[model samples]
Target: MSQEQHYTFGVSTRAAERLRSLAAVFAPSTEQLLGSLGKVEAGALDLGCGPGYTTELLQAQLSPAWTLGVDSSEHMLELARARCGPKLDFALHDVSRLPFPAPPAELVYARFLVTHLREPVQLLRAWSTLMQPAGRLVLEETAFMRSEHPAFQHYYAYLAQLQAHYGQNMLVGATLGTLCEAAGQHVLDAGVRVREIPAAQMAALHAANLPTWSQDPYARAAFDAAQLRQLGETLREIAAGAALAPAVSVGMGYVIATARPPALVQG
Candidate 1:
């Protein structure tokens, strides 16, 4: 996936190393939604629902109740709908113009969606029309606060060098609090929770996410084969070194924006 297609070859070389050891140590937004729903559940809207991994997880947890995974990528939607089938719906819909059967949703959640978007607030506001009053709007983003890991320094430095050429916002590691607040909720609930994905699983994420990042129609223009190879070599070095942290603290924060009928933030 090239940069033009809104994808990155790898998320963060340094973070991936730490996350693998501490997968369970972090908070998952899906877990948060299950907590908020208690017993009663209605519908779920997953923005940027790629490959339907999270959507399928939600399906496993929330049964009988239907969930819709929406994305602009027709290919992604096809794969998602194929993976989950009609029991769990999938649509090739843009966040800006959500084309759901219903107007508002009981839960409108986007994981790793806002980061990719240049103006995610507009998309959030659009979801407001689709969310019922007091409904939940969850935006889970990975915050790149700072890595204290001694080994991560070199790997992070390399990633920064690569991103300077590929794209500045490749990882979408930015201010989640500001965006959540801008997309105002009567009660803005946001918190940072770190998680890890084991080396094996980290490898899987790379397997799954690398293709998307490389094939991006626009973004890849800046990507150099030699640079990517260098990054790959450096990441492998970091991944192989040491006993590894029990849990790498990656900024896997959950920023929740509850919907209001009248809406809080003015256009």
Candidate 2:
């Protein structure tokens, strides 16, 4: 999947609109929990916002609190803008090198973005600086257990490998709390939610197989015939199998790591 084809994964635009309600699956509960801690400051940054799904919600849920969505792919950014209704700002930016004017922000948010990141510590260091006193950096990420299917073990084994090959960041234990404390931020609170993404839906996503979804745009990015065959076999097993226990969906919430300057923490 080339960086350009990044838009092809997951739900359709119409589905995204309908399931826009589902998008709140993670943060709404999270913000409420964090709210009991304290109120978020005026403005927030939606880091690695992808298609602006969460960005749109951040605007409504955290109303009166402004948000900015940043993503690396121009295509994803465009789709995000289209889904969005002009309340929040969107920008094309690489997470490794965030492009915020002024200094940091009052609140920083990210969902399912950092796990695909290699230098997550670098990201924490950068975003932490974006905060003023008591400001927070929130993040969420997804993980899957590949050994869930005994019958289709080989199939999912290959699919998981393919996902990794395509440059997906594997942050096995880098949840917001773990990373925040490591990065010297005060860990306010963190939690995890386990849910089902539906094996049928997973099969559908594998079949749609967007070009951007594979990162195939960046020169010689086609999967080998063997790989595709294995993926097909994997999806087939998933569709046919009984009691596939691979956690269908899980979101780790690091929604409210109070931001304090490194200098302040040092003293």
Candidate 3:
């Protein structure tokens, strides 16, 4: 990871729980992406694996002989190790650095990680080097997200600014397939996934996600703490009210990209 850019959502119990909740929400789509890949010859790695949720899903979906979850946060890794078994292991490393010493993985999977990097394409190129010939790289990222509530919209706008401030791309998912191609990977499947969460679920989702944002300096800088607190209260109130519930929906757009490293050229 670049010293200048940091993922503002620092590791915390609340953040960890929020990640696990998100993993659960996106599990089906992730499973679908993995299922589409068929089988693999070697190990699978979950890059930026938080709480090992996706790692577990990868094991279940692909049944790769070896599964490793890599994250920079030891706290998140602890949560992951607790949830996973011996078949699934955790590694502490900066994903951008790709410092782990191991054999090339047959599958490299990442969820919501690319947007945090300054040079996601370059990182993709580096990750491609960690793959065996024809190894698949699966990436999941948010293409776009919107909520029916104005407060949510207001929050996302600032979130986008914060990501920009950190030299990250909030909409990087939109161009991942092309980036994969630019990185000398062969794009096999690239598609968008649209999911609408009911008002209750949406409210719950934000409620879980808010804690990390609330405590984040970038979030506070983007929107004052008082406003974020009010938004939280509003989300709770919305969740509690039946009449207000069904009228609201949270729309999320995800891009799932699967690509393979170009076959090694024989000398």
Candidate 4:
């Protein structure tokens, strides 16, 4: 795996639970994006599928001939396989690399995946080569996040810094459309979907992720252990409703693009 693909949040059992909650929180927007595609006869590929919630969504929404969920972490793939039906298959592969184990897909979908990539435009170009001529490339990533709570704000700042250290961008969603165009794909649609998540829910998500990320070498070096502990406690309090805060507004940018014919690809 490339250094850029080193996910800061380790795939612990707690992280899997965090991902499940995250999938629930973001499902509506993801469903809306998939609905735009209607049905795909060829196949659908879910990149960085985590515990496979998004992969399940893809199957339900598109009912493609086949569905494959790929992730870099084998532990995540194991968790995904345990819950998924026979129709859904999970593969252990670094999504940032090319020549995936499966065949070319009719619809390639990734949610919160590109933010972890160093060369997102180049990866997009590689993905286009693995798609059918008319295949659609769908991406959903974080454009920005806003919260009134100091703990939440501080947590996001730390996350942004850590991702930057790994050559990734926490706010890569804002550039998805431009990246697609640069990759030689035809942009069909692109826009931001803003969602308001309850402070309690957001806190719970962060609390789950805290244990894993706070232990990272960079996080440990850059942040004080006592500060992280205090932040975790605050997040837990908010999650339990013992602390009150306003909802968090998150902006998710989505882009739907189609692979251009081989002749149309830029040199």
Provide the overall lDDT of each model, using Cα atoms, as 2-decimal numbers.
0.55, 0.58, 0.74, 0.88
lDDT of 2 by residue, 1-267 (tens): 013222223444543443343454454554554455445557878877767877775666666356888877776677887777676689877667645653566777777677556546656777777776657777766544233544335434544454456454444333667777677777766766555555644553443442233444432254465566565566655655533535344344444576665456567
| 175-247: candidate 1 lDDT, tens digit per residue | 5556656666443666666555454334333333334445554435655656655555544544554334333
Query: Which tens-of-lDDT digit does each residue in 1-267 have in candidate 3?
Result: 334448756688887877866777777777777787888768999888989998998888888888889998999998888878576889898887855655788888888888888877778778877776667788888777766667567656766887888888777767778888887677876767777655655566676667777666767666777877887887777766633644333222333333442443322
Assess candidate 1 and give its lDDT.
0.55
By lDDT, rank the candidates, best first: 4, 3, 2, 1
Q: Total backbone clashes of model 3?
A: 0
Count clashing residue pairs per candidate. Answer: 26, 11, 0, 0
- TM-score: the better of candidates 1 and 3: 3
lDDT of 2: 0.58
User: After best superposition, candidate 2 residue 82: deviation in angstroms?
Assistant: 2.0
1 versus 4: better TM-score goes to: 4
TM-scores of the candidates are: 0.69, 0.70, 0.88, 0.94
Q: Report the C-alpha displacement of residue 229, candidate 4, in angstroms.
A: 1.0
Best by lDDT: 4
Q: Distance (Å) between predicted and true CA of 113, model 1?
A: 1.3
The alpha-carbon lDDT assigned to residue 72 of candidate 3 equals: 88
Worst 10 residues of 3 by lDDT: 248-257
Give the runs in model 4 whose Cα sits over 4 Å from its true position: 1-4, 261-267
